[model samples]
Target: MTWLVTGGAGYIGAHVVRALLDEGLEPVVIDDLSSGHRGFVPEGVPFVTASILDGGAVEAAIRDHSVTGVIHLAGFKYAGVSVQRPLHTYQQNVTGMATLLAAMADTGVEQIVFSSSAAVFGAVDVDLVTEDVAKNPTSPYGESKLIGEWLLRDQAVATGLRHTSLRYFNVVGSGSSEVYDTSPHNLFPLVFDALLEGRAPRINGTDYPTPDGTCVRDYIHVADLAAAHVAAARRLEAGQPLEPAYNLGSGDGVSVRQIMDAVARVTGIGFEPELSERRPGDPPRIVASGELAARDLDWAMRHSLDDMVRSAWDARRASTP
Candidate 1:
């Protein structure tokens, strides 16, 4: 059986493609190259350069590859940018998801492992968010992801399609290859860039109620996230009952100061960070309890915060021109 991986050339999607290959499954990729790089697609996998919003192109790719399942990872993901451009976020995340689902229905593809986000949980007061947490998105990006989950659930109920939505927290670390790096909007990559350039990193918002007076987030290794995606796809293929949603994250939360310290420890960079005012709609703390995913999908994180930072530092070093 072949799998269609949307955005397979992207940072996280490329790692998923590598995992799929490791499982001895063929993966066909579709990406528009807007934010994804063509060089990241592994050799011998059929890759189509097209947007998911184009129904005809998506349908053609599905039919050509005999795709039985889809790992949907293509969407807008910048939280702060989404607040500035709500319409674009909704169009790419919500409307584009509808277009892909319609294509899947047309082609009789019944399984999908969607890449959702923990931002869907919004500003929850709980220490650890679970699958049953009430979803109240705080930004256009988060709202778009919540709507994507609703679309998946509605399609499953109405069409007998089996799906799994992995609501991930902060995705960090580098893949085995140095070709893939962090997203430009992410905190770690920005810090990495500053350190590489002999510049000071900037820390935004230090008045939050967290232990370090900084925002706290659960950072999951990219490889671990990819493993969960493969597991979800395998379970769905086996006709297992669909889970409502799975939270993919480490159970522990790391603050911004902690991350900065890790970077300094790993890279020997002692540059002080520039303090800045908080960005709008920034959550004080967001941590995930992966017990549900651990029980249902047997997913567990193997990398530590030190490991994540070290691996990222190594990749950043290798990527330097």
Candidate 2:
């Protein structure tokens, strides 16, 4: 079956596209290239350079490719920045999602897999977040993701749209040296950039109540995340039941210091990370249980912490030249 991968030129989207191909499924890409790279989409995959908000363009891609389903990943995804640009965030995420759904509905497309976020459950106190956790989004980005899920839920009820939203925790690592995380706001890229420039990576909030006096978060590999999307799509195609949402996360949490240690070990860098005060609204710990996803979507943390750091570092280094 052919799938439409929105934001397919981006790091995670690109990985999803490749994963689709690996499973003998066709994938058509539609990306605005706002924060995505054209080179990331593999050759021979049909590419549409348009925003998801452009209903005409989105409809055309859906119809032209005979897309059986959509993996919606296009959006303004910066949570902290979304706080300052709430309107832009809503425009891209909320409105863009509505537009995409409208186009899909108009075209009789019946299935979709949304790329949701753990941001929907901001600053939780839980040891392991499940899908039923209270959603109190802290920023427009998170709010928008929650709204997108609502859109899907409402549409599913109204039109029998088969769908599921995957709530990602902390996505890291590379499936291939060809595709790597490029977000300036993400942790892996920031740390790698600091080390490459011979500067110490800064660790915000070493006074947190966690074991290492730092924040703890669930980290999952990009490849594993991609596989989950495929599983969801296949399940939908097979007319199997699925939860409205699933947290793509590590059951156990990893501290900031542990990530730093992994980076140093992988890169052979010995510099200590600079400790600083916690950023406002930053949660000390937020890990999630992927039990539901594991049961339904074959979700698993296939890469170790060091593997994540090494693969990401290697991919970033490969792009340096």
Candidate 3:
């Protein structure tokens, strides 16, 4: 039984496809190429250029591929800008998720692993965020993710669907040099772009309550995160019990200053980040405990902050003209 990986040509999705292949599972891909590159789809994989919003197209891909499961990842993921494009965000993430689920139901593909985000929590006033935290999403992007989770839950109750949502903070690092994070809004790419352009990377806030006065957050490597997804899929395939959601996090998160320091050390480019005023509603820290994921899904901080920086730098350099 094969797995259908929606958005499989994107950075995290591409890495997820590799992880599934490494586990001896066949993965078929469907991507709209809006934010994903067609070149990122591996040569041997079956590729369908379509959006999850197109439910008929999604269902056709699943039926054509004889898919038994799915890993849903395609969405408009910019939390900050989502406020300005709330309808678009809902259309892509909320309506798109419903379309995907409807297609899965039609195809009888009940097993799924969703690429959820810590965005669902927004800026929570807590030391360590958990699965049971009162969700108070502040942006359209966050709200869409939370609503997607709710849809999954409702589907599970109504149709006995086997599903799990993986909530992650900041996903970085590449499993292969061929695949890299290309999100224009992400930190690694922004910093890499600045460095490659011969400019210093900038930090948003430097007077928070955390050590070094920089915001702290969990930053998991993409490969490790992908492995957890595969593990969840395996559990579902084996008819074993799985949690509704798991946070793949570094319990004690590294600060932005620490990331800047690591990047400089790893890339051998010595320069301090320029500090600016904190963005509105930016939290001082938003770390989470991955103990549950560690126990069930083989989740761990396998890469250090420096390792993450080095790998990301290598990929960015490799992709440069």
Identify the leading candidate in terms of lDDT.
Answer: 2
- Candidates sorted by lDDT, best first: 2, 3, 1
Model 1: weakest 10-residue lDDT segment is 173-182
> Which of the predicted structures, 1 or 2, would earn the higher lDDT when compared with the native?
2
Q: Against the true structure, candidate 3 has what lDDT?
A: 0.92
Q: Stretches of candidate 3 above 4 Å error?
A: none
Query: lDDT by residue for model 1 over 1-321, one digit each (tens)?
Result: 789999998889999999999999889999999999887888898999999999999999999989999999999989889989999999999999999999999999999999999989888998889889899988999999999999998998999888989998787887775445658888888998888788899989999998999999999889889989998999888888758789986887899999999989988878788889997767898889999899878789888888898887887788777
Per residue, candidate 3 scores C-alpha lDDT tens digits across 1-321 of: 699999899999999899999999999999999999888777899999999999999989998989999999899999988999999999999999999999999989999999999888888998998888888899999999999999999999999998999999899998888899999998999999899888999999889999799999899899899899899989989989999999887999999999898998898898978889998898999999899999999889999888898898898888888
- lDDT against the true structure, per candidate, is 0.89, 0.94, 0.92
- Local error of candidate 1 at residue 115 (angstroms): 0.4
Off by over 4 Å in 2: none
Using TM-score as the measure, name the better of candidate 1 and candidate 3. 3
lDDT minimum window of 10 residues, candidate 2: 275-284
Estimate the TM-score for candidate 2: 0.99
